[model samples]
Target: MRRMDTKTTTEKTGETGDNAESPEGAGSAGADIAAKTTEPVEAAEAAPAVEPLDADALGPADEVDKDDDEDDDEALFPDEAPASASAGIGGAAAAVVSAALGVVALTGTWTGKVVAERETLIGQIKTSGSGTPAQQISEIYADAWHSVALVNGVLSLVALLVAVLVLALPGRPSWVRAVAVAGAVLGGLGLLLSVGTYFDLFLNLPTAGS
Candidate 1:
């Protein structure tokens, strides 16, 4: 039989037996083992938590902010920002300007109008064979020239209006400048002819004895 006796060499106050130790020392040893294991585990968790910087807004954070699921969802859906209406307004203005330019190209300049007149003439030829070929061609030119003249007159007035309205608009358009140029030249040429006709320079000359 094995037994712990009171007078044994391992049980006396001056000895420290293998299986018998003071309560305070045992508690201290256990606490040390727990602390060592816990510390290393915590350190291991901390080491790999640091993430490199990336462009992904939904990616993980730095080591210091190692909160897992809570913050990731919050970061992904940030606060709502206001939309810039001015951007839309600017884009719309550009579109309006492009459309106005297209109109001018079709109807504003002499060359543009001449081209359109040619198209209309071709259409007329197709629809109604109303006259001889030479007459049809002559009527086409006549109609086109008259339209050019009237357009010039209207554009002259519009040019003056544009100068006045330039400061009033939200912004200047590319078409406005081009229209102004065409309007000014045609208007000036007509004005000069009107002045000459008024001063009798373009009047009919009298026959020798009539």
Candidate 2:
């Protein structure tokens, strides 16, 4: 009977140990779960909040970037800018040339004088032998005068046409247009004078009999 009681007491002690160990293990497991949940919540709360971007705040920066890109493009293609400038310079030069031609037509160029002298020499050769005095006068003096008038008229016409072409073209500068207009006026006046001289309206030829 003493041995039986001792065995019973040992079984009871083992059951008590099991019960105490179960509660401690359960408490430790609950603590671990609570710690895991609280750590994640604390981490989420400590992290910085993200804000949305504003369009108005970025507008000036975008515009500045666009302007810089345009400037870079201009720098890369520098030759393109000068092409239009060269064209303008060419137009201006053409206008000046037209004006100069008009002045030369009015003032009588060396070419016109040389042409007149050549015609005079030709007339003298043709009238050397048996032409009448009237025929000689017409050949020598009238032909030479008409030749000069013809050359002047041609030069005046060229100047007038060039000026007209410049005026007709689009996008001419103010100074170019002004010069072209002056050239046209001068050419027209020169052409009129040349016509009068050619027709003997300005100066009549001397009578052969006289």
Candidate 3:
């Protein structure tokens, strides 16, 4: 019976020790788990502070990116000219036409008419007799000259209008501007000559055989 009691007591002691070891092991495992859980948070707190992204620091780079995008957009259409440049070319064409017409009217058509009419009047004067016939021929020649001069004056006025149109056009070329100025000068001179001839301001033609 004593041997049986000794064996029983030894089993009880082993059970108590197993229970104590299990509790210690469970507490140590819980402590390890808790440490693992909070270790990352502690490490994060101990690390260096991270700065926020600064928007102003990227401003120049963003502007460069925008400039590149704009360049790409502009390069998309390689053949088309700007609207203002096209308009300037059209204006130059108009100026050329207007100036050319003005020059021709003042120098070619009106001058030819004046020369022809003057020749006719001189012929009539040379062939007239010293009488009422001569007087009538002289009067007719004077009237005809005045009428031709008036017609020339109207033509010069038309040329002046054309010159003004040329000069007023937008973005004319240098040559076009020069032509317009020349046309204006010639038109003005033609106008003066026409007025002078019409009023007989500078001319004294022989009349009635004189």
Top model number, TM-score: 2
Candidate 3's error at 182, in angstroms? 1.7
lDDT of 2 by residue, 1-210 (tens): 999999999999999889778988789999999999899899999999998999999999999999999999999997776566877888788788889988998999898899889888988999899888888889889998999899999999998998998898888899999999999998898899999999999899998777
Candidate 2: residue 205 lDDT (0-100): 95
By TM-score, how accurate is candidate 2? Answer: 0.71
Clash number for model 3? 0
Q: What is the C-alpha RMSD of each candidate to the true structure, in Å?
A: 15.8, 6.6, 7.2
Clashing pairs in 3: none
Model 1 misplaced regions, further than 4 Å: 1-111, 118-138, 164-210
Candidate 1: which pairs clash? none
For model 3, give the 10-residue run with minimal summed lDDT: 99-108
Q: What lDDT does each candidate get?
A: 0.52, 0.90, 0.73
Q: TM per model?
A: 0.25, 0.71, 0.56
lDDT for residue 45 in candidate 2, whole number 0-100:
98
Q: Candidate 2: minimum summed lDDT over ten consecutive residues — where?
A: 78-87
User: Can you write out model 3's per-residue Cα lDDT over 14-108, one digit (the tens) per residue?
Assistant: 99889778978889999999999999999999999989989999999999999999889889977777898877766566556555545554555
